[model samples]
Target: MTLPAPLTGVVPPVCTPLTPEGEVDVPSLLGLVDHLVTGGVDALFVLGSSSEAAHLTDSQRRLVVRTVVAHVAGRLPVLAGAIDMTTPRVLDHVAYVVEAGADAVVVTAPFYTRTHPAEIARHYRLVAGRSPVPVIAYDIPVSVHTKLSAELVLELAADGTLAGLKDSSGDLAGFRAVVTGARARAGITGFSALTGSELVVDSALALGADGAVPGLANVDPEGYVRLDRLCRAGDWDAARAEQERLCALYGMTGVGDRARMGASSSGLGAFKAALYLRGVIACPATAQPQVPLSEGEVERVGKHLAAAGLL
Candidate 1:
């Protein structure tokens, strides 16, 4: 199916369910997809930060994209992350995901090596030139160590070098600048501005963002879906209430002890733990090198789910 111009609504970065041995749990993955689809997500994003893309091997990433694209079967647009260290490697991922049937590819600034704004621009231009599907710029300064400026984003949007932006930078002022620019700029139409923040979907949408790619939605897609609808329906009071509920639920991301693991472990572990507690996935095990949540942390996740009426 053709992706909607300015794609909107809840687009969860679907979690990559793993077995005890850390291999992709195909059945569990498919079941999770069914869960999200049934919960009314407008689209699916695979191999994203929430999916533990950094930990998966190249073949595993390909398998993830292929499986999701095949399972979704065009019911909704599927976006795949082509995250890598540099331009050439990212383009390689772009080829693989596009061949696997991703409707659009999400990319970030080149990482691990020092870069300039000019280099970032060049990188995006190169990728956009070769990619068959639409290319959405992913501004994740926390991970990539480079913030995509609103000016660069607007310039790219005006010239057709970018089709959308998925901002996880946690900088609403900057996000709003891109959103406003995308709307105000001439010769730029259907340029989607999606917030990747789980805590501020209402604010993002209220500021004219097209949609959200909240990672927490993997655990409770219906909640995010309801939030999106309430926002779109212009029920500010209800939307604020729903957003606050989800924010409280978002507390589950801190279940893991910081001394024992990194933020990725805590956040992603909490998400998978919530899924397992909710009976969405068979196992809550995260990928290797990342610390697994202890029973106590899992209990905390369960408590959060119960508080949110999810369990």
Candidate 2:
């Protein structure tokens, strides 16, 4: 199917559930999808950073896209994250997502290389030019160590092939530039600018962002739903308060620690622990990506939830 319009509002980057045997736990994943939808999310973002896409195999990634599409069943748009360091690989993954009936694809510019602004434009152009579905440019400076500059994004915007953007860089300057560029395009349905930063959800919204795709939404669905409602109703003060609460809730997950694993198995382990502590999903999704969280860390997560009134 062709993609739906550029997405808005909260799109939870779902966690991939794995059995104790380290297999993709289809049942658990489906259950989480249902919970998130019922919890009032506007869309689903699968195979994203929070979903541990790097740890999943090619076959598993395809399965995830398929499972989420089936679970959503057209109730909401499903944007599959295309996590690859190479252009060809990302294109191939985008093809798979479209064939599996995803609504759009989220791709960060080529990582591991110091990509130039022109190369960034070409990368997004090539993906959007070749893909059967719409594309959402994902710019997460922390994970990829590469940024999709607004100037480059605007250059691609002229092509009308780019679907929109998911700005995970968390920099207000970067966010402002993208929104400003997108706003100038008359034909474009306002290029989607999604904030990955929970701390800036309201500010981003106030600054003309379409919405957000926060990792914190996984732990505090009720809070995010409230925030979304408040923002939509133009209650910036209330929304900002709720966004701060979400940032506090996400602080429990040890966000800074995941970067230390440096492509090891331990990275995925800590994420699963956060979800477990929040009672969003059970533990042992996969031991291959990272080692299990220590007892102290796990207990700390519990205290975090209790302190935040999440438990």
Candidate 3:
């Protein structure tokens, strides 16, 4: 299917469900897909940061893409995150997921190596040139240790090397620049500017972003969809109310004790815990080496769910 020009609306970066044994739980993964699809998400993004793609084995990552693609069955676009340290490693992942049926591939700037702007541009241009499906740049500076500048992103979009961008940099001003630039560029069509900011979906859309790829959407897909529709319908007040409500719900990500674990543990662990509490997934187990939330933290997640009416 042709990716929507400026792919818009809610696209949840799916959380990878794992069994107690640390293996990909296919049943739970499929169940999660059903939940998102039924919850009115516009698309599915598998193998993303939320999916623990960095921790997953190559085989497990391929399974995730293939399973999500097969289950989605063209119902919505399935974009897989082909995350790796550099271009060559990332290209291997790109080939695997694309062959497995991902509608598009999400790549990040090269990490580990001292990368130049020239190297970053060369990396994306090479990937996009070789990819069979559309290429969407995943600009998540926190993970990659490199930020995708508005100048570089707009240049790539104008050149047709990037079909879209998933901005997780949390720099709203920079995000706004890319959003405005995407619109202002004369011949750029279908270049989506998607925000990974869950707490500011309404703000991003209001600033003229094409859509949001909020990870919190997995916990509350309907909320973001409502926010998106509210923004589109020009119901700014209601959208702000809904967005603030979600921002409150997002507080659960911090409920996990910081000193006990890292942000990924606290945040993603909270999300998985919320999913398990909500009955959307059978297991809340994250990949190994990541700290698990304590029972008290799990209880806190339930309170957030109740407060949000998710329970």
Who wins the TM-score comparison?
1
- C-alpha lDDT of all candidate models, in order: 0.95, 0.77, 0.91
Clashing pairs in 3: none
Ranking by TM-score: 1, 3, 2
Which residue pairs clash in candidate 2? 265-289, 265-290, 266-290
- Candidate 2 least-lDDT 10 residues: 259-268
In model 1, the clashing pairs are none
Error of 1 at 145 (Å): 0.4
Give the C-alpha lDDT of model 1: 0.95
Please, what is the TM-score per model?
0.99, 0.90, 0.99
Put the candidates in lDDT order, highest first.
1, 3, 2
**Candidate 2 local lDDT, 49-155, one digit each (tens):** 87888888999999999998987889888999887998999988988988899888899989887778778777888888898777888888888888777777776
Who is ahead in lDDT, 2 or 3? 3
Which candidate comes out best when scored by lDDT? 1
For model 2, the superposed segments whose C-alpha errors exceed 4 Å read: 1-4, 255-271, 284-287
Q: In candidate 3, what are the lDDT values of residues 1-311, reduced to their tens digit?
A: 66787689999999999998999999989999999989898999999999999999999998889899999898999999888987889899989888888889999999988899989999999999889988999999888889999999999999989999999999999999998988898868888999999988898998999899998999999998989999999999999999999999999999878787899999999999999999989889989789999999999999999999999
Model 1 lDDT per residue over 1-311, tens place: 77799899999999999999999999999999999999999999998999999999999999999999999999999999999999999999999999999999999999999999999999999999999999999999999899999999999999999999999999999999999999888999999999999999999999999999999999989999999999999999999999999999999998899998999999999999999988989999999999999999999999999999998
Question: What is the Cα-based lDDT of residue 105 in candidate 1?
Answer: 94
